[model samples]
Target: MKALYFTADKMMELRDIAVPVPKKGQYLIQVKVCGICGSDFEGYMGKTGRRTPPMIMGHEFAGVITEAPEGGKFKKGESVVVFPKPFCGTCEYCKKGLVNVCTSGICMGVLSADGAMCEYVAIDEKYLIPFSPEKLPYDIASMTEPLSVAYRAVYKISDEELQASDHIVVIGAGTIGLLVTAMLSYRKAKHIIVSDTQEFRLETAKKMGAHTVVNPASGDFEEAIKKATDGKKCDFAIEAVGISATAESSLDALKIGGTAIWIGNAQKIVSINMQKIVTTELSVRGSYVYDFDGFKKCVELLQNKVIDVSSMITDTYKLQDGVAAFKALENNTDGKMLKVMLEV
Candidate 1:
């Protein structure tokens, strides 16, 4: 088997490796498609510490069960999408179904667990969610994880707040942000506004049903959003960029008593105006990845065409070109690449 690994010296190297053998209660997955996430790019640029040196970095992926252990629930040739978050089922948090925050959990590709950036991976049977290859393509199935993040972010919003005419702003036009707006559109939310600094992403947002798209670099983001709403602030906001500026802008653009659902995890320390949060009686909540039910919901949403992400993929690469794929993400100065997939 061949795998793309981040070397200790800070570069993606494609190397030949032995195919993994599944342990007890595990299945050998022949990885079909793997999407390089934003975090993967961050790791490539040495921005994140989660992906240490010489690690396989990919969590958003789909594969087929090639070697299932005897008595396994699934069989060989069955396609599935992996719930890459490893958790201890006996933990208190997992027992309460808050597996997203599982204290004893490990996020594959992001943390210590090796991920699906290779041709084959041995995954525990518990984390595999079976799907039909005919109904959903491998690349789209691979999107289950990231789309689940967007689904959870919007799903966390109060149902009473999703008025058909309520003003909403998504403060980033990346994949999660775009999907957040897509989910908003799916639920018939009105007055959707997507803000970003890139022209291509804003265009993609517009296509995804953003009622308005504003380039934050063009002018004051909050002011532009306010102008769109006749000087009124958004009733809800989702901060998809984890920087201090975008995180603060979510509060800056919200109406009195509004809520902001934060979904990004790029930076550690971010400064916000506590005065604005208190004075406006606003609520800012941090949303984690989805629980088991939410993950299933995202899959159903994708299958039902409720959240069409067919246009989300910007490029594809063979495993042999994996290094070039990561390089494309790193050198994406034009902001043209939205999602890059590796065909393993």
Candidate 2:
């Protein structure tokens, strides 16, 4: 099998490697499509230390099952989507159903474990979900991870007693931001505002159902958001960019008593106006990756065609062109990139 491997010198190389055998209680999947993620790019650029090099680099993926446990729910040669997160079900966090934050959680492709970049991956049988090819395409199935992340963000809003179609603001117009906007649209948000410095991404947001797109680099974004909402402010604000500035922007866009959710990976710290938060009675929270049920719900949504993830795929590259795909995603070249997939 040919795979792209991260090297000790921080390089990507395509090499032939031995195919892995499925152990007892594990299922082997022949990789069909694997999407390049932002975190992967960060690791390649030495921004994130999750992957130390000499590792496979694909987690968001879909494939056909080549092997499964006897009498398992999935059959050999069955099409399916892989849930990237592997949890130790006995952990305290897993006991509470928060598998995403489990202390012993192991994520394929991004961590120490072997990922899906290769032609085949052997995963735990319990982490595999049967998918209908007629219902969901392999390319779209590769987006299950991002969609699940988006679902988890919306799930956090459930405790606030907010209604669908409420005024909402989503900061950042990247992949997650765009996907989150689509999820919010599915929830029937009446007014959805997306903010970003890049005009092209903002335009994509509009096509995806954002009612308003703001360029924060040009002027006062908070003022523009307030004016658009008639001063009532957004009922909910979600920060999709993993940075302090965007997090603050999300908080600033919220109305009094409204809630704000941070779903992005922010490595640095951002100062918040504590006085304003207290006086306005605002609630700010952080949301991590999806729980077990969130991944299942994401699969259901995709299988039902509730969200058009197919359009999110901007480009596809062969496994040999993996380096090119990562570079394009990193540079955002031609404004022609969204979900870049490796055809393994």
Candidate 3:
């Protein structure tokens, strides 16, 4: 089997490797497709230190079950999406259903895990998500990770304020931001405002159902929010850029009692206004990856065509062109590229 390996010097190389056998209670999945994530691009640029070199770094993926574990729930040759993380189910967070933040959790395709960049991976049968291949292609199913991440972001919103009557703001017009915008649009949110410095990404946000997009590089995003909302403030805000400035922008866009959720982790620190938060009675929270329940719901949403992901796949590259795929995603400075998939 062939696998793409990231080197210590930040280069990608295709190497021939022996196939991995499934461990106890695991299935051997023949990887069909894998998506290059923003984090993956970050790792390529040597920004995020999560993925060390000499690693197979691909988590967003789908595959066909080539060998099933003994007494597995699903059979061989079943088309499935792979959930990237494995949590210690006995932990407190896991018991409370917050698997994303479970302290002992470790994800595949990063650090010590080999990930799905190869032709085959040993996956726990419980993490396999089944969907009809006739209706959903390997390309779209491979996107379940990002879609699930978007779902988890929306899930972090205060339940009372996520309805159609509430105006919301999404800071960052990238993939996760656009997906969040789509979710809000599908749920009939009263208004959706997206902010970014890049105009092209803002344009994509508009097509994804953002009622308005603001280029903060030109002016204040708070003012843009006021204009777009007709002087009304947003009830909820999602910060997806993972920077201090955008997180602050999310806080500044919210109503007096509104909530803000941070999904991006770009910087180690950001300046915050404690006085404003206290006086305004604002609720600021951090949301990690999806829990199992939310992941399942998002998969069903995709399987049923509830969230249209057809437009998210901007480009696809063959596994042999894995290095090219990384370059394409990294050099997408105009923000024209959304999701790039590897046809394994």
Candidate 4:
């Protein structure tokens, strides 16, 4: 077996390694396609401490089962998408169905756990979700993880609040942001506003169904939002950039008492205006990864063609060209690249 290892800062190496043997209840999957995430880029740059060196770094992946326990629910040769985060079913959060934030949950590829950026990986059977290859291609199926994240973020707001929101702002037109915008559009959001520093991303956002796009680097972002909303500001804002400035922009773009959902996790700590939030009665909610049911729903959405993800995937590369793939994402100054996939 071959694996792409994150050896050091801004470095990746394809090395030969022994295939992993399936654990007690794990299934051996032959990885087909894996998507390079923004967090992988951050780990490559040594920004986020979540990823350590000499570990395979990929979570968004789809594959075919090569080995499975005898008489298991899922048999060998089945196509499946992995849910990266394995939770302890006995945990309090897991018992409450909040598996995304399970107290004893650990995300694969984030730390010591090697991920699916290789020829094969042994994953627990509980984390595998079957998908039809005829309906969902491997490249698109690999996006289930991120799409689930987007779904959870948008659905964090209640159905009443989402339907009543006449104006919604999405900060940062990254993968998650663009996907969030697409989900909102699919739900027929009245007006969708997306902001980013890159015009290319803003253009892509428009293609994803954003009614208004603002480049915060060009001029005043709030002014653009006010103009887009007719000076009423936004009824809801979703922050997907996890930076201090963008996080603050999400809060500032909302009208009094509006809700803001923070989905990005790049930064561990971000400063915001507590006074404004307290005085204006604004609500700030943090949305993590999707629960198990949410992940299954995203797979269903993809299988049924309810949400089109064709536009979100911008580039693909061979698994051996992992270094070039990471480089393309790192040097994406023009922001033409959105989601980069590695074909194993």
Give the best candidate by TM-score.
Answer: 4
lDDT of 3 by residue, 1-344 (tens): 99999886458999999999778999989999999888877877887687788889999999999999778899999999988888878988889988888788678887757788889998887788899989888998887888888888887654555654367899998888989998888777778888998898888888889988889999877888888887778888899988778888988998888788888876667887878789999988888878898888888888888888888788899999998888777678788888888998
Model 3 TM-score on a 0 to 1 scale: 0.95
Q: Lowest summed-lDDT stretch of 10 residues in model 1?
A: 157-166
Best by lDDT: 4
Model 2, span 1-344: residue lDDT tens: 88888774346888899888888888889999998887777777777577778899888999999887887778898998888888888988889998898887678877567688889888888788888988888988888998999988977776345464368899988788999999888877778999988888888898888998889989998899888888888888999987768877887898888888888784556777888789999888888878878898898998898888776788999988987777666677545587788998
Instruction: Give the Cα lDDT of each candidate.
Output: 0.88, 0.83, 0.85, 0.92
Instruction: Give per-model TM-scores.
Output: 0.97, 0.94, 0.95, 0.98
Q: What lDDT, from 0 to 1, does candidate 1 have?
A: 0.88
| Residue 243 lDDT in candidate 3 | 73
Backbone clashes under 3 angstroms, per model = 0, 3, 1, 0
Query: Worst lDDT window (10 residues) for model 4?
Result: 103-112
Q: If ranked by lDDT, best first, what sequence of candidates would result?
A: 4, 1, 3, 2
Q: Better model by TM-score, 2 or 3?
A: 3
lDDT of 4 by residue, 117-172 (tens): 99999988889999999999999999899999999999987778878889999999
